[model samples]
Target chain A: EAGVAQSPRYKIIEKRQSVAFWCNPISGHATLYWYQQILGQGPKLLIQFQNNGVVDDSQLPKDRFSAERLKGVDSTLKIQPAKLEDSAVYLCASSSRTFGYHQETQYFGPGTRLLVL
Target chain B: SQKIEQNSEALNIQEGKTATLTCNYTNYSPAYLQWYRQDPGRGPVFLLLIRENEKEKRKERLKVTFDTTLKQSLFHITASQPADSATYLCALPTGNNRKLIWGLGTSLAVNP
Candidate 1:
C-alpha cells in the first residue's frame, strides 16, 4: 500500500509570507494529524482530525495557522505571516483507528521542510 | 507541567553490540508508551509499543521495557547494524488518550 504522500518536499519563503502544505494520507485511514518538528526536537502536534471534524488543535496557532481535512480525506495545513520560528519540518501522519480510544501506531509522511528567511 | 526526556547525547556503539536508549517522564500516567525511529529529513516510523500493564515487548531484534512505577522506558536494539543508526524517540499518550506527548529523541550511531 502507498504511504502518506506530501507535496513540494521542501519550501522556502520570506517572513510574513503565506505558505500552505498538503497531505494525502494512507487510503482508508480515518485519522489525520499535522505536526511541527524543530531541529533536534521531537514533533509537536499542531492539529488532529477524525474524519472531517477536528479532534484536537490545542497546540495550533489559531491566529496564524489553520488546517482542514475536507470530506475526511485529503488535508492541508497553512501558515500565514510566517516567522523564523516556523521554519521547521511539517509532518503528516495517519492511523487506521479513530480517536478517543487507545492510541494506535501512526504512519508518517516524508514531511515538508520549510525554511522561512 | 508534564515532560518527557531522552538522552540528548548521541550513543555510539560498534556493530554487533546492543544499543540501549532510555526515556523518562514525570507528572503523567500514560496508558501506553511508544518508540519510533527517525532518519534525517524524514518523519518518524513506529517501532514498538508497550502498555502500562506490560513489562516488556519485543519485535525481532528490538526490545522495549516499560516501568510505570519508575515512569521510564528503555529501548534496546540487539546486534546493532549501521542501518540502525538514527534518532529514536519515545512518546506517551496524553491524559485524555487522544493525543501524544513526545520526547526529544536520542541519536544512535552503530559503527562498522
Candidate 2:
C-alpha cells in the first residue's frame, strides 16, 4: 500500500506572497492532519480533518491560513500573505481507527519545505 | 496545553550497546504514547505505542515503557547498530482531541 503523499516537496517564496501545499492520504484513512515544524522544533498541529469536514483547526491562523479536505481523501493547506515566520516544513499525516483499537498510528508524508524570504 | 520534551543532544552509544531515550511531558494524561523515528529531510515513521494502563510494549529490538504517574516514557533499542541512528520522537494526543502534540525529538547515534 502507498503511504501519504505530498506535493512540491520544497517551496521558496517571498513574504506577502501566497503558497499552497497538497496532501494525498493513504487509502481508507479517515483522518487527515496538517502540521508545521520549525528548524529546531517539533511539528505543531495546524488543522485536522475527519472525512470531508474539519475536526479541529484551533491552531490555524484564520487570517492567513486555510485548509480543505474535499470528499475526505485529499487535503490542501494554503497560506496567503506569508510572513517570514511562516518559513517552516509543512507536514501532512493520516490515520484510521480500526475495530478493537482505541488508538491509531498516524502515517506522515515527506512534507513540503517552505522558505519565506 | 500539553507540552513534550526530549533531550536535544544526540545520544552516542556503541553498536552493540543498548540505546535509551527519554520523553517527558507535563499538564496531561494521555491514553496512549507513541514513538516515531525520523531521519534528516524525511518524515517520521511510527515505531511503537504504549497505553496508559500498559506498563511496557515490545517489538523486535524496540521496547517502550510508559509511566503515567511520572508522565514520562522511555524508548530502548537493543543490540543497536549504525543503521539505528536517527531522531526519535514521542507524541501524545491532547484531551479529547485526536490531534497529537509532539516532542522536539532525541537524536540517537549508534557508533561502530
Candidate 3:
C-alpha cells in the first residue's frame, strides 16, 4: 500500500506572501493532522481532523494559519503574511483506528519544506 | 504547559555497541508514548509505542520502556549498526487521537 503523499515538497516565498501546502493521506485513514516543525524543535500540532471535521486546533496561530480537510480525504494548510520564523517542515499524518483500538499509530508524509525570506 | 525534552546532544556510539536515548516530559499525563525515526529530509517513521499502563514493548532490536511516575521513556537499540543512525523522536498524545506533543528528537550516530 502507498504511504501518505504530500505535494510541492518545497516552497519559498516572501515574508508577507501567502503559501499553501497540500497533503493526501493514506487510504482508509480517518484522522488527518497538520504539524509545524520549526528548526531544532519538535513538531507542534497545528490542527487535527477526523473525517473532514476539526477535532483540535489549540496550538494553531489562528491569526495567520488555517487548514481544511474537505471530503475527508486530502487536506491543505495555508499561511497568510508568512513570517521568516515560519520556515520549517510542514508534516501531515493520518491514523486509521477508531475508539476500540488501544492507540492509533499515525503514518506521516514526507512533508513540505517551506522557506520564508 | 506541557513540555517534552530529549537529549539535545547527539549520541555517538560504536556500531556494535548498544545505544540508548531518553525522553522526559512534565505537566502532562500521556495515555501513550511513541517513538519515531526520521532521516534527513524525510518524515518520521513509527518505531515503537508504549502505553501508560504498559511498562515495556519491543520490536526487533528496539525496546521502549515507559515510567509514568517519572514521566520518562527510554529507547534502546541493541547490537546497533551504522544504519541505525538517525534522529529519534518521542511523542505523547494529549486527550485526542493524533494530537501529539513532541520532543525535539535525539540524533544518534553509530560509527562503523
Number of clashing residue pairs in every model? 0, 0, 0
TM-score of chain A of 3: 0.96
Give the alpha carbon lDDT tens digit for every residue of B1-112 in model 3.
8889999999999988999999999998888899999998888899998989999999999999999999899999999999999999998877745467789999999999
Distance from true location, Cα of A48 in model 3, Å:
0.3
TM-score of model 3 (CA atoms): 0.96
- Flag the better candidate by TM-score, 1 or 3: 1
- Tens digits of per-residue lDDT for model 2, A38-117: 97788899999989888889999999999999999999999999999999999999999786766889999999999999
Tens digit of per-residue lDDT, candidate 1, span A73-113: 99999999899999999999999895465969999999999
Candidate 3 has an fnat equal to 0.79
In the range B1-112, model 2's lDDT, one tens digit per residue, is 6689998898999999999999999997888999999888888899999999999999999999999999999999999999999999999987566568899999999999
Compute the lDDT of residue A43 as modeled in candidate 1.
97
Candidate that beats the other on lDDT, 1 or 2, i.e. the better one: 1
* Ten residues in sequence with the least summed lDDT for candidate 2 chain A: A96-105
Model 1 spans > 4 angstroms off:
A98-101
Assess each model's interface with DockQ, reporting 2 decimals per model.
0.83, 0.81, 0.74
The local lDDT score (0 to 100) that residue A6 gets in candidate 1 is 97
Kindly indicate the candidate among 1 and 3 with the higher DockQ: 1
> Which candidate comes out best when scored by lDDT?
1
Superposed Cα deviation of residue B43, candidate 3 (Å)? 0.7
Q: What would the DockQ be for model 3?
A: 0.74
